[model samples]
Target: MQARSVAGEAARNLVTGTTRALWWALAFVVLVGGLAVADARVLVRVWQDADAFRSAGAAVQTLASEREQVVDGTRCQALSGVAGLTGAGALRPGAPVRAASMPSSDLTVWEVTPGVLDLLTTTARPVRTATGTTTGGLWLADDLAAALGASAGDELVIDDGRVRVAGVYTWPDDGRDRVLAYAAVVAVPATGTFERCWAGAWPVDDDAAGLLYSATSPGADDLRLGQLNSTRGSGYDLSGLVDARPTAVAPAAAAAVGLVLGYLAVRTRRLELASALHARVPKPFLTWQHLLEAGCWLAAALSVTAAATGVAALVGSPGPYLGTWATAGMAAGTGAAATLIGTLVGVLTTREKHLFRYFKER
Candidate 1:
């Protein structure tokens, strides 16, 4: 087959030449890998580290009627109501109030379930749970409990509610990972609890089957709406969950820049070959035509290697791995483009031997 001959010649060139192609390839790999690491640590972390997407809701009128909804994970579906905050003041006596059974000691450690917590590692504080309750209580966030200076079995008042320390924990911030630190949790009565209001509520779990909510208007109206029951609405799927598209882009860009440099390095030695073929081939052939072929092949090979290595490293560490095919494809395309541009420059200069000589002299 004609394909076989081309493949054979390409292989021969690789081995026959003692040119610095191998060295250049090694340099390209190092540049790409180093840049990738730096970009991921700095640029990608900036976008992915902070809470970019907000899960919010709005409520119209006072929810007087009893209503309940089950949640699976701490997803937007679990959000009850993004009810407009009517009053801009803190919760005071006689004010309308909403309470969640699963309280969160800290805002970052969003309580998704009774004992489970979810938070980005960059949130600063982590959750710490204690076991074997005593005089006070056991449930507390790591920071809150640490601030109390209480150890296991020690009694203290949190938000006015007496509690006992249990345990401390550190969680990974990677997007896919979930923290199921606590298993069993019981609420402390608000009467003797802290005066804080927001601390008494926590986000619903994404996987929780239902949501439980109660409205209280002290000294105005107190009605027993027995736990309202409601199931999550349909059409709720996690198909669009986990966005690595943005994260993958940065590395792809860096890889592209490296690929361009690689193409230039390769074409430097291939100048004579490209010139010889020019006469045998189409008249006035663009240097870019030959460079394009080399560019595509180089990008294809580099992209595959980068993705495989990136994925392997991500798997071993706490960072997100290349989860989506789109990410890999984008990375590959970026690399290909960079290589093409770099090769084009090199090949174009070869057309003018004078320019090529100037570059060598410089």
Candidate 2:
């Protein structure tokens, strides 16, 4: 009952010609929403790309630098570098191993054993049966497939292994890096010497270089000198990708500040909300009205902002920026509150017609 009464009072306060104000407020909300959506999309993409690039960069850094470290006789745990038909040996430090090499004029291929293949999913389902029933054999990046006009079942040949289209995948940097090719990685053949083609790591001779382990890397640090690190390159920079929480939260904070200021503005009006006690209406009523207006506007703004953020998350490029949703919510709440306060302040400073006459007579 109280809610309805308050709402009824608020409805009465709605000015008929203030369509302009309402429109202006709505326009502001829309603008803020659009920005938030754009920001979120950009933020998501940037974070993803940053993660990918960082992973790639880290891999490049690791491979490039590790060579120097190992050459100095530091005895990093080593694995084989033999390029089998699948080119597994040429596996980059932080990328997926394809079942066969991709047909690439620019990219090169090498071979590794089943031990080297690092399947993303815990259940690494095989692409084919021994009888060969056309169980998609080609593994391509989602971005790569979109780029190269290729689909599942497309036969791609690069080094030695023959691979059919198995599945399409997407990495964080797939769009930005322009890397499209098949990675041929075979699971351990049923009957191999080690029961796996890709030999991961065993504390072998330090001089050898297949897959090396070092103490500095995240996973590698856990492995003692004697035990080999089994985890393969996940084709992403996990550390960089997962740490986007901080970036995502920053926009929310800014929006919050905007909301706070908006509340103050609404209550203070253009005159003097500080003098509400001197006005015709009680201070409580004034404050209530302000709260109601603030709440409504804030709700509207937040809704728009959330939509914007979601859009941004999907479409925007990778980078650090304020997300659209957070921006909208904060701005709307603050704007509404401030407007309420400002109007109330102005009202407080004004004298009623009767009061003005009384004072004049006095």
lDDT of 1 by residue, 156-230 (tens): 543445544444443223231122222222232222211111111122222221222222223323222111111
The residue-level lDDT of candidate 1 at 296 comes to: 38
Show model 1 residue runs off by greater than 4 Å.
Answer: 43-137, 140-195, 199-263, 278-333, 344-362
TM-score of 1: 0.43
Candidate number with greatest TM-score? 2
lDDT of 2 at 241: 43
Candidate 2 regions off by >4 Å?
1-5, 15-21, 27-35, 51-116, 119-185, 189-279, 316-362
Q: Each prediction's TM-score against the native?
A: 0.43, 0.45
Highest lDDT: which candidate?
Answer: 2
Residue 53, candidate 2: how far off, in angstroms?
Answer: 1.6
